[model samples]
Target: MSEYKFLTGLTSGFTPVIDAGFSLEDYRHIDLSVQNEILSQAQLDAPEAFQKYLDNFLLAQGGQIPWGGYNEHRGLYRRSGLFSAATEEDLIRNIHIGLDVWAPVGTGVLAVLDGRIHSFKDNNNFGDYGPTIILEHEFEAGKFYTLYGHLQRESLKDLQAGEKVKQGERIAALGDASENGNYAPHLHFQIIHDLQGKEGDYPGVANRKELEFYLSNCPDPNLLLKMN
Candidate 1:
């Protein structure tokens, strides 16, 4: 399917990451590029330092969500070995495929559309997705999926495969470092055109060589959130 059709219903639809009182006015776009001052100031390798950065950022901006990750080449990944390949020859996955909402731990995460639970798993490794959930949505164009990564462990409790999730329903909560792969609390939201038959997990970052394919498959999540 053409990439344009992948975001057909979602762009003109509702917000998916937060509960209420969320707006573009309440959002501060985050910069992870090498030129960004925020990255230079914060000690990203330390969880506490990163958390302090997030806390101060939100407090100063009065924003509920610090969003922006689609196709962004981030230097912050250097702090985590998980983003590195076993060998130097292999391209590293630093380009973010999803839009992340940095919020307090235990923040409620919602679904943007009606769908069923495609799969859920705890990818419990450092710099991994932690407790993740993939929801399958049936759109007129075709079947696609929405992935919610870095969620609280309790969010997946008693969740059955193929369980129905309605539009705007609470599906999960923001997880902390201990449960969310040791990063600051946030919801890693991505729209996947195809899962490639993978379940429970999919790549949230792309190698530079296959950048085009991953970029096309995972369009800017703001297309769904419409947060300006």
Candidate 2:
């Protein structure tokens, strides 16, 4: 079976990764793409300003969770040399491949499906997923992986490679700007069909050239969550 079909068929209802308090009704899909005119480069360059905008956005919308960004072309990574180190235009990785759930620090991050800890690490970089964890799952004929990024360091404290994580169980907590790669507090969740031998971290964004391959490899996370 195809990876996308395998995933969508595995879940019958919405699967959430963030705190359980907020229902589907509480999630407001916020646009962080290049097309969003209200957001400026300056705001995204600074986590505080971007967070203030998000606060106001949630307030204006009367929501608790602001999520989206799968396959989105974002301008949020331009400020960091992490994504702009490439000299070629097509080599710049600007297309986001994960779903971001924006929330307060310490928000509980749950496991979407029954899986065991494949790997975990503190990928501390200027624009990186600070404390990340990858889980491996297999049911019936399908086998795949899930990545949870921007988590608190404490989440990785007692974690072991083979540690089992039950579905809907609290596995991590959201990290702030200091620990979450200098970004606002959020959970970066992604579905990966193949890790290519990488662990603890994988490319959350892809360049124009590798977009096709990455898109197919990393299926849209909504296939499982069905949040929107």
Candidate 3:
């Protein structure tokens, strides 16, 4: 099915990922580009450092979604060797495949649609999804999946594969540095048209070689969040 048709099916009563103090009016665009000023002045290697940057940005924007990350080529990942490739010939996966909703720790993460648990795992690494969950969804458009990464470890307790989760249901919570892949608190939301036989774990970044394929497979998540 077309991306527009799939997007239309995803827009519904999803729970807010941020605190009550925030709203659409408070949302601000973050620049992960090489020429970004705030990034130029800060170090993103440490989670606390990134948190400071997020705090300042939220204060400046009046506490809103620090939304931006789809296909963004960022230098922030340099802090972790996990993003490095053994051969220079292999394009480094710096382009983000998902839209990140930066918010505070413990923020409720709601399921965007009705689906069953597909898979989940604790991808513990320097730069990885600490606790991740993937849900399988089917609509008139087609069968697809929604992935939620950087979730609290406790969120995975008692969750079984194939368990049903209603739309707008609280499936997880935003995790902290100790649990969420050592990054700032945020929900990594991705749409996968095909898992390619994968389970709970999926590549959240793409390199130049496979950019075209991934870009088409994982459409912009803002199509569902609608938080432009």
Candidate with the greatest lDDT versus the true structure: 2
Worst 10 residues of 1 by lDDT: 1-10
Error of 3 at 2 (Å): 4.2
lDDT of 1 by residue, 131-207 (tens): 99999988777788999999999999999999999978999998999999988888899989889989889999877
Order the candidates by lDDT, highest first — what do you get?
Answer: 2, 1, 3
Per-residue lDDT of 214 in model 2: 94
- Model 1 ranges off by over 4 Å: 5-8, 11-14
Q: Note the Cα lDDT for every prediction shown.
A: 0.82, 0.93, 0.81
- After superposition, which runs of candidate 3 have C-alpha atoms over 4 Å from their true positions? 1-4, 12-22
The best-first sequence of candidates by TM-score reads: 2, 1, 3
Q: Write the per-residue lDDT of candidate 2 for residues 114-209, one digit (tens) a residue.
A: 999999999999999999999999988678999999999999998899999999999999999999999999999999988999989999999999
Clashing pairs in 3: none
Query: Higher-TM-score candidate among 2 and 3?
Result: 2
Candidate 3: global Cα-lDDT?
Answer: 0.81
